[model samples]
Target: MKRERDHQFECGICGAEDRYLLHNVRHRTPSYRRLCTNCLLKDHRGLFCPFCFSVYEEPLPIDRSMCNKCPSISHKPCIPSNYPHHTPFICPSCSSPNFSFFNPTTNGDSPSGRIIDRDSARALVAAAKIAAVSMTKAAAMAKVEAEKRVKEATYAKKRAREALERLAYLAAKEKEIMEGKGGGSNYNGLYLAPPPPPPPQITGKVEK
Candidate 1:
């Protein structure tokens, strides 16, 4: 079924005409009836309250808007003037006040205008604690795995070092043999002397 078109009031200030552009248009109250979008967002207090066109000349004592859902307090008004007030006072997802301090579901990406409450607040905190502990455990396990890998590498290095030392000792023995030192017998295969040249061939005719 087609939805009915809502009656929209013009911003008495800028005269911008359009339901979507109008600030707080969804919540049609007396004071906001003819106000422009700019003026409405600038309202620091209940200036644009539906009951009263509360444009208090002086800043109202209550500077912040309390979340109807979680009731968490935020520096930025739950209802920003530039954005649409889709879920005004209460959080749509958590159903808590938008002013909640600890919100698991209420990350930076959470949609605007949702409410949160005290019960939900506690739940959010508990969930966060569990997540933190889980992350810590995973990190510890990774460190242990890394240490094991390091130990294996060290063992391999030690074996290589021993093999190199044996090679050096064998080379020293071969050197001693070449220099006519007695150690030649110890390195049988490694220290073979060149064959003596054949006796000068008796090719020349034997002298009579």
Candidate 2:
């Protein structure tokens, strides 16, 4: 009897060691099938077993209509028999069904059941895309508004500084005038006063 030798490899997704192992060897031809650490993070399509969740990557197509469902190209199936019952039940990339489904929700509340028609599914996908776009636009608008406010504040501060400078200059000029240091009034005859003479005292003495 030949003792089976085990060859283990790291998971491509989470980098878990020894999560994946070589399997299904025939006549010395090595057919690798295993899961790793990294696969756990993916939704359903790219998930992996608990032991291999750390190393598994997204599965790839090995042949026509046949894919390994793991990160690497191997001759055997990566998903174990107890798949879909694992965590992270859906693929983040394509949103395909994974092997982790337990008591899967297949129908609607109606007794007859609600079939997912192609139009409805397409509409749902479209709606999700539109919502995402709207969210992006909203974020951009918020950023623009913040920039506008900042600019307004900067302009206001500048205006205030200029006004203060002008006020200081006017005050300095007024102080100089009060101290009689201003050369002379620029208004020469704009405000001139005349002298008045008095003759009432002489008239009162003559009458007495």
Candidate 3:
């Protein structure tokens, strides 16, 4: 029969020898030093539910809720059902009315069945309306600015084209003057009348 040897490893945090270290290898490793199961749970004391005072082992879907007024945490299901739904849930320790329950279900009291104050609902609607109007105005202003820029660009292009055409016409006129054909005339401006035909060179010496 073969006997299995037990290999022991030391915990980095508690310095205790153990066969395995308590850690979640699948996700992120905790920043705290490696420790055994007991030490690890002790280090993360905040993970325990305030209502049940128990720590979760696996990544179970725990209904965690936080008090808005204070830093206390609790399990949502543990809160009493008779707690006021219209007002914010208050922390028992702080007594400040700012904590809110997560994922509140609708009860058959109103038409929408959602518990909401009339004043709060009106404020939300007013804020939404103001935001919509402001956005519409901003869009209109942006469109006007864009159209103005486009018109300015188009005018600048047209002016550039006209200047080029004028330059071309002046260049053509200058070339014509250099070639001695001013005012579109075919005769060269530099040509003389052939020096009066040289007096008809005498046939033999002249008539005696």
Residues 11-44 of candidate 3: C-alpha lDDT, one tens digit per residue: 4555665454333211132122334443343333
User: What is the Cα-based lDDT of residue 158 in candidate 3?
Assistant: 100
C-alpha lDDT values of all predictions: 0.45, 0.39, 0.48
Where in model 2 is the C-alpha error above 4 Å? Answer: 1-116, 181-208
Q: Which candidate number maximizes TM-score?
A: 1
Q: For residues 1-208, write the lDDT of model 1, one tens digit per residue.
A: 1222333545544565545434332222112243333333332222323212222334543655444644333334434465434455532223422432222234455564334555444433333333344346556666887899899999999999999999999888677667774333445466555566888766757778
Which numbered prediction scores highest in lDDT against the true structure?
Answer: 3
- Report the Cα lDDT for residue 142, model 3: 69
Query: Which portions of model 3 miss their true places by more than 4 Å?
Result: 1-116, 181-208
Candidate 1, residue 3: the lDDT equals 27
Q: After aligning candidate 3 to the native by TM-score, how far in Å is the CA of 200 from where it should be?
A: 22
Cα shift from native, residue 151, model 2 (Å): 0.8
* RMSD in order of candidates: 20.8, 22.0, 21.9
Clashing pairs in 3: none
lDDT per residue as tens, model 2, 1-208: 1222222454333334442221111111122223321132222223222222222334633431112344322223444456443243322222344422111135877564544455334333333333344356566666897999999999999999999999999878766764564243445323223345766664435543
After best superposition, candidate 2 residue 159: deviation in angstroms?
A: 0.6
Q: How do the candidates rank by lDDT, highest first? A: 3, 1, 2
